[model samples]
Target: MSKNLVIIGSGGDARETLEAVEAANQAGTADYKVLGFIVEARYGTPGALVSGLPILGDFDWFAGRAGEVVAVGAVGSPVLRYRLVERAARYNIEFGNVIHPGAVISSSVRLGWGVIVEAGCVLTSQVRLGDHTHVNLACSISHDTVLDDFATLSPGVHLAGRVRLGEGCFMGIGSVVIEGKQVGKWSVIGAGSVVIRDIPDRVTAVGVPTKIISSQPPANWITQSGEK
Candidate 1:
């Protein structure tokens, strides 16, 4: 039997997630009957179509139906994704993972709920991805890498062996993290940057070898409007 599924978001990431789900179903790896998207009332209107799927409703749509449907978070921002997951939790909704059929994931990799591994991603041995982690296209995670809850990896990012990414860390597109390096919680790595050393929490780092540019409180990232 196919399980009912809903994606939480109406943006590009949500559409890409829908494509991944469809690809998984086509490959016979998943049996999900994706109903539609669930977004905030302010962001989406009920009955609207997104990538040919209806905007089912807001988070309130999960009310009284939590036992019948499972959801996955698809936003690009780790903090925003975490916020949506928490909102869904208020209605007792359970989360599910979406792995694109094109990705290469090792059997030893450990994935948590609401995780999304997009097409062309390569997760090597013993990679542990915590709850609600979003790994975008063509990224490579090397052996023994650990990504804590709400981590986001942009397209073409590469992590060497033994890398550790703390909660809600965002690795920009084409970024590279060397072996044994750690990026702390809520930190943002700029695009095309090369990280060689450990990065502290709640800071924005950029350029070659990654220099810390600025730092902000958790509230700055985890805002109601989902803006930094």
Candidate 2:
């Protein structure tokens, strides 16, 4: 029997996750039947269709319907993603994951609930992805890398062996993190940057050899654990 699944968000990331789940369902690797999306009240109208799927309702729609549907957070904003997960958890809603059929994942990899590994992603041995982590298109995560909760890796990002990405960290497109480097909580690595050393919390770094341009928190940033 296929479980009813809902994706929270209606943007590009949400559509990507929907595709991955659709592929998984077609490949018989997963038993999820995607029901639709739950867009925020501000972004969409309930009962409207998006990508052929209905927009069920806003976040509050799940409040009293826990355990009846499995949900996956599809937003790329780490803070917003955690907020949805934590909120849904209060109602005992079960979480689901999405992995594209084309992804290469090692047997030793451990993925937490609601993790999304998109097509062409390569996750090497002993990789640990925390809850709601998003590994975008063609990203490569080498051996023993750990991505804490709500970490978001953009398209074509590469992480060398034993790297640790802190909670809610965002690695932009085409960025590279050398071996054993640690990226701090809520930090943002700009596109095409190369991280050679550790980065501290709540900063934005950029350039070929990444430099911390600002120590300020990202706009609308919240902790990965949903702490204010």
Candidate 3:
């Protein structure tokens, strides 16, 4: 029988996870098939099957499967994921990681559960991705970089070696982080910004050489560039 996998959550992270799964299936390296998805209570959209994968149930269904089902967290916010993980632990449910076929990750790289490395992403030697992290399209994460849980790299974002992104951070599209920079938790690096130093926590920053402009954080951070 083919390996069976189930994903939890149906938000943006879940959709991206589904897309990555399809990409892997297309490459013929997918060892498992998505059985269904389980969202939070009062959150699931019935028949909102992504790519034909049905919405099976809610958190209750996560532990509903016997030993065969591999549950994965596909949530974006670190705080949100932390809650999910904590709740899942009550059922003793473990999670799985999704690594896309097009991503070039070194053998030395270490990853925790529910970490999604998307298409065309590169993780050089000794890179570390914490649980539930999301590295999106075409981003380059150089050697020894570490991204904590719920940290997101938007499409085309580039990180030089030894960079450390704290939990729940968001790097906008086409942004560049120079070597050894440390980005704080819940921070946002705006689109097309160039980060050259340490960024503090819970702040919204942007610009050519990224500057912290506002004392209050934005609702979201995003960039839509197409290249390095």
Best by lDDT: 1
Q: What is the lDDT of residue 106 in candidate 1?
A: 99
**For each candidate, what is the lDDT?**
0.94, 0.91, 0.80
Winner on lDDT between 2 and 3 is: 2
Clashing pairs counted in every model: 0, 0, 0
What are the per-residue Cα lDDT tens digits for candidate 3 across 20-100?
887777788676688877777688676776657889876666565556667677776555666676566567676777889
Better of 1 and 2 by TM-score: 1
User: lDDT tens digits, residues 32-70, model 1?
Assistant: 999999999999899999999999998989999978999
**TM-scores of the models, in the order given:** 0.96, 0.94, 0.84
Worst 10 residues of 3 by lDDT: 219-228
Q: What is the lDDT of candidate 3?
A: 0.80
- Candidate 3 residues lying further than 4 Å off, grouped into runs, are 26-28, 64-66, 215-228
Query: What global local distance difference test value does model 2 have?
Result: 0.91
Error of 2 at 89 (Å): 2.2
Q: Which rank order by lDDT, best down to worst? A: 1, 2, 3
- The candidate that wins on TM-score is 1
lDDT by residue (1-228, candidate 2, tens digit) is 889999989999999899899899899989898889987788999998889999999878887787689999999888778787777777788888899999999999999998999999999999999999999999999999999999999999999999999988999999999999999998999999999999998899999899999985454545432444
Q: Candidate 2 has which clashing residue pairs, if any?
A: none
